[model samples]
Structure formats: C-alpha cells, structure tokens
Target: MLTIPKELPAGFEAYGRSTDFTPDNLPARLQAAHSTKAGTWGLLHVLEGKILYQLEAPFEGEQLAAAGEKIVIESEVPHRVKFVERGRFFVEFYRKAELTPG
Candidate 1:
C-alpha cells in the first residue's frame, strides 16, 4: 500500500482552497495530470468516500484517501486524482508564510 504524506512542509501556510468537488462535479483539469505552481503546495482533503491520488514522473505513485484523511502535494509536482467511490473533496493551496516587518 502506498503511504500518503500527511503534513505540509514547514513554514508553509494555507493561502486558499477549492470548492468541494464530487465525482460528477470534478473539473477535467483535476482529473488529468497537473501540477501546483512553483513555490506552492496543496493539500487534498477527503470529506467523504475515497479518492485515488496519482503522481507522475519523478514522483510516480498512487494512493487512496478516505474520509477525514489528507494527502500532501509537493510544489511543481505533476499529480491528479480520481474518484474511487462517491466522494467529496477539495484542494487547499499553501505557500511559504511571508515574514511581516513589525
């Protein structure tokens, strides 16, 4: 069984998130191999059912995430997801937290 990383890289903070998506409502871009922008990361949170997460090229592998679980996405890594069962999930984007001058 493939193990999914549960934690995001240190210093990164959540910047945004996608609306919850189900099998019938998932976008084609997400169903096909794609990647996060440079310096950005993503966390796929499964809210219901299960999803198949697949990585491409240098990170080639796959894993299944069920309700209440999350999969960490590395920056610039090609990856995609498919519904394994009736599922609902969303991707939360992250980036290094900018230091603010006090």
Candidate 2:
C-alpha cells in the first residue's frame, strides 16, 4: 500500500513552484525515478484529469491522483509520475524555513 503524508512537516515553507504542465509538456526527468534533495519536499497538485504516481524502492507502490487532488512527496524518496489521462499539474517545492533573529 502507498502511504502519503497528510501534510508537510511543521517548520517547512514553500520555496518554489514549477510551471503548469500537461502530459505533452511534462518534463522527461519527471517521468522517470527521481528524488528531491535532502530537506526538500514536493507537493504535486493536479489541476485537471488524472495522473499516476509511482513510488520506487523502499516505498514501492503507485497511486492515481485526479483533478482537485494532490500527492505529497517526502524528502529524498524515489518516485515518478505519468499521465493516466490528459492532465494539467504543477509541483510546489518546500523546505525548512530558515530561522531569522529579530
């Protein structure tokens, strides 16, 4: 069974986001197994249609996310995505917020 975190860990903040992508425009790198850098997390938001998310070794499994749904990617976890139907989506990255002395 695939387990997705219900939310990002506390103290993490959004750092960046990817351009909206459709199946035709999805990057090659995202279609193959890849992982986020240490301390980084990713939220894959589906805007339209459906997508297949596959988690590689150590957490091997797959889940399908549809429009209005999202998938949380844990830091350093190997995973990949593909179109289950024509879809539009974007990935928002997050990392621990840096402490600032006030």
Candidate 3:
C-alpha cells in the first residue's frame, strides 16, 4: 500500500536536482508510469494546486498531494504522478543507502 513518510530517512541524500512539472509540460515517463532506482527515493513537493499520485500493483491507490504537502516515494516502487489542476511541483531524488549499493 502507498505510505507517507513523516520525515526523510537517515543517510538519505539528494542524488540529483529537483524537477518541476506543470500542466503544460510533464515528462512522458512520469505520465506513462515508471519506477525509480533500486535504492533511489523521491520526494514530491507541491508548490501550488493539487496533484494526483498513483502507485502500481501490490500497492494500488491514489494519493492527493496539495500545496504545502509532499509525498515520499520508496525506492524502486512503481508509481506515477499527475497534475490535478494548474500548478507546479518538484521531485528530489535521494539515495538512502549508497550510490552503488546493491
């Protein structure tokens, strides 16, 4: 099932830069549905409006992330995010373990 992390896990560090998505231009993978790295995490912060985040099977459900709210994505978890209204958001990738941890 989809879950909400109260805070970031220990040792988790930003792997890449934060990404912004708007109603006008959204990534194809994020739109079509995709998963993150095996040890990669994602934090979606909604700056304005609302977003509809969906998870794949085994944890099939939709989450509403509004302004001032955020969602923590598990590593390798199949999921996708969508814009509920005209707004913007950013996703910060993290690596809780190590960059090359297996």
Candidate number of the best lDDT: 2
**Model 3 spans with C-alpha error above 4 angstroms:** 1-4, 97-102
Put down candidate 3 lDDT per residue, 1-102, tens digits, no spaces: 457555678898987856678988788788767988778888889999999888887777778989999888877778888888889999888886565756
In angstroms, give how far residue 78 of model 2 lies from its true place: 0.5
Runs in model 1 with CA error above 4 Å?
1-4
Error of 1 at 79 (Å): 0.7
- Model 3, position 89, has a per-residue lDDT of 94
Model 2, span 17-57: residue lDDT tens: 99999978899999999999999999999999999989987
Higher lDDT: candidate 1 or 3?
1
Instruction: State the lDDT at 61 in candidate 3.
Output: 71
Give the TM-score (vs. native) of candidate 2. Answer: 0.92
> Between which residue pairs do clashes occur in model 2?
none
- Sorted by TM-score (best first), the order is 2, 1, 3
> Ranking by lDDT, best first?
2, 1, 3
